[model samples]
Structures are given as C-alpha cells and as structure tokens.
Target: MLSTKSFKGVNVFMSRNLVPPEVFDALLDALKLNGADVFLCCDPSRHGHNDFHIISSPDHEKFEDLKAKGCNLLGPHCVLSCAKEHRSLPKQGFTCCLAMDGIKVLASGFDMDEKVKIEQMVTAMGGVLQTKASVDVRFVIVKNVSAAKYKWALNVLKKPIVTINWLYQCWNEHRVVPQESYRVLPFSGLTICVTRIPADKRKEIEKIIIQNGGKYSAELTKKCDKYKVARRWGHIHIVTRKWFDHMS
Candidate 1:
C-alpha cells in the first residue's frame, strides 16, 4: 500500500548489534505510524558477523516494511537524535542522522554484548555511536560508571554523563525525554504545592524553597504534594507562624 504517512522525505537508520529481531520490526512499525520514512541498516563500521543491512526492494514503499529502502535524497542535517529541542520531532522535521552518521554517542560498560545492545538501542532509536571519546561526543551512556571512561567524562571533560536508564526510559516512552527524570539531586525532584505565601513572599520564599529541595504548584489538585491556605479549602492544612518559625 502507498503510505499515507508523510516522511516529508526523511529516512531512519537501524543498528545491528545485540538487537532482537522483534524489536527491530517494532521500531520500524512505530516510526511508520508517525509518518516517518525508515531504514533497517546499521553503521557500516558494525559489519562483522551480524546482519547490518536490510535487503530492501526498490518497489517497496512502507515505513513498517522490513525491506525499507534508502533513496538518494534525505531531508536535512541527518538529525537522528530524538529530542524535544528544535526540529527533532518527526512531523516538524527530521535529519535522518541514523542513515548518515547517527548521533555522536559513546557507550561504556564491562560486558561487550551489553555495550552492543546499547548501540543497537541507540541506532534503532536514531543515534550514532562514536568509537571513542571526543569533543564531538554529545552523550556518554554508562551501565558501569566505575569504568575509567566514566571518570574521564566526569572529571576531565566534564561531559554530560547519563546512565543506561536514560536510554530504556526513552525507548519505553517512545519519545525524546528530559534527562532530569533519570537523575537524582539534592533538590532535583519536583513537588508541586498550592502555597499560600503572599504574592511577594511566594516568589522569594519559593525560590528559597526550591533551592532547598522543594517545588511549587499553581493548581490545587490531588496530585499536589502540599498545600498552604489562608482559609480552610477543603481538607487542606493551614501553615501558622509556628510553621514559618520551624522552617526558619
């Protein structure tokens, strides 16, 4: 069938390293549903003993089809990384970096298979793997932070280091996700609250609160973590001077 989904003339790439066949097919299907032209090929560097290329037919034209072909023309910058920033979204615009070079990714771990799996995940999800560390590296994914490379990322280069959870989360969510959720910080967690501090004090005090590991909320909902009240708004609690004194 002729695809109704508009790739806007974009192509996607897949990596063939430690990846399951089912996952590969699913990835292409998902992309096709969202109107993305897709490919099931891998970085040419990865051709050793595994399947890196999908035997595509020139007559075929469907996103989900395993035999997806690559054409002479790809959209723009070969942007394979899925991110909320700029034109990363499929519909707005895509770069198909996966087909070209993929995202500049560095994987660190003890298990070679695991490392390969990570590579597969990245390429399937639209990322490129760099063989080594460099200024061009955009993200360093680590399952073993104890590795020397992880420390280099931490101390020497001061690179943006992310855990393997970041990758799985993105795959599960099927979208580019903010790294904040994968991190744990002293005051990083968000806690929405309906606060009753006066407008002037609210901003100032909330700044202090946020700095000290708290969050704010505008709506009074069940999902709200805390509530401050000038009057009894249902079962909400009112903070007294004692509470302020305690906070101080």
Candidate 2:
C-alpha cells in the first residue's frame, strides 16, 4: 500500500519542463496526493528552507541558481520513489543520475533473492526490469561476465552489460555512476581525443572514455587511438561527429 503521508511537510517545486504536460500533471497530482506542499514554480520566498526543486536535468539553466540558494535538486523519479516507498527519501545526488527513469534493464547472473532486490530498486526509481533480454532492453546487469547470458547480451544482442556493482553504487550514492567504469575493460588500452565538439558534449565523451578504461587527451597526441576530428594521422583513427552518436 502506498503511504499518503510520504511527503508530509515537504515543499516541492516542479519545473514546468520536467516532463510532458500529461506526465507532469500526473506527477503534480501524485505529489499533492502524497501530502507535499507542491509549487509549480521556484519561488523561494514562498517555500521553506528545506525545499526540493525537481528539474528535467542537472544541466537545466536554473540548476546553479537553485544550488546557490541551497535548494535540493532532484529528478522527477525521486518524487515517485519517495511516494511509493512511503517516505521522503534523501535528495542528495539525485540530480546527478537522471538516466534511471524509464530505463529498461535485465538481470543476467543473479539468484532469486538478488534479482528480486534489483527489481525492487529499479522499479522504485522508475526503471523497468525485464525477465528476458529483448531488443528494447537497454542494459543487462550481470554477476559473471563469462556467463552465457552475459555473452549473449554483449555479443549477440549487442546490449551494454554492466556488473551488479553498478546498480549498488548508484543506489548507495543516490547517483548513477558511469556504468562503463564497472564493465570488464570495455575500452581497455585505448587513448581517445576529442576536438571541435561542444564543451558539454566533449565533457560527456571524455568521461565515458575515461570510465571505459581509456585515456582522454584534450589535444591531439601521437598516442591517441581515436581522434574525433579531421586530422590526417596514419596511426590515429579520425572520426566524425556521427561517431559519438554511434558510440553512445
């Protein structure tokens, strides 16, 4: 049973761009029904000191401003999870990992108890846990990389396989750490460099590369295995912007 007093005395400010209109309405109604003092806008003067500001992404324009005002920034899933769990969850690090919402996941090498726990956490965070590896399953959480299911997910289905630790890390930190860092050396022994990319995109790519067991060079270097620019280097593989899209 869902608890109506989950958000009892909490003040929540939902961004208008947090979700689609219908989805936003549903979330707003849910927050109110769960006993939160919901606000449609970020009017700090009207809210208390412990107010939470729910935004679409941490990159939202108001993120720094909200942080400066000491407001808790969280994703929409935090509200849903808190409501379902019947308590106001800790808002720390919630905004850092926004990809969990609506993500389709499959568990590959876990016992019954572990799988159940994984399902509970995933669903609580607005993620979908699948019983089988389907085309739509975006990620496969595995206990053993050598397991048949893991191989099928990686080699056959071409799905990104991550260890159970990835899930636990995200839960513990309240933020989804890079899954590539928990994978089995997916890009081991590779050095990559990015150029002519937007600052935001470059940061994302660099993080992914470093997490996947690769080194990132801000400038073109002779040791770079992959260079995302029009540089004619015989040893380096020059790629276009589309490479980022394909790799991601």
TM-score of 2: 0.42
In the range 1-248, model 2's lDDT, one tens digit per residue, is 44357877888887676554655877787788888888787664533445777776555776666767666666666666666656664555334333376689999767899999898667645577999768888888877644547768877878677877788887666666787677755544456777658898888888887766667878765644334333455666776767745654
My TM-score estimates for the predictions, one after another, are 0.37, 0.42
Best by lDDT: 2
- Given candidate 1, what's the lDDT at residue 98? 37
Off by over 4 Å in 2: 1-4, 17-22, 44-49, 93-182, 190-248
After TM-score superposition, the amount by which residue 83's alpha carbon in candidate 2 deviates from its true location, in angstroms, is 1.1
Residue 189, candidate 2: alpha-carbon lDDT: 46
- Alpha-carbon lDDT of model 2: 0.68
Clashes of each: 5, 0
lDDT of each: 0.49, 0.68
CA-only RMSD, every prediction: 15.8, 14.9
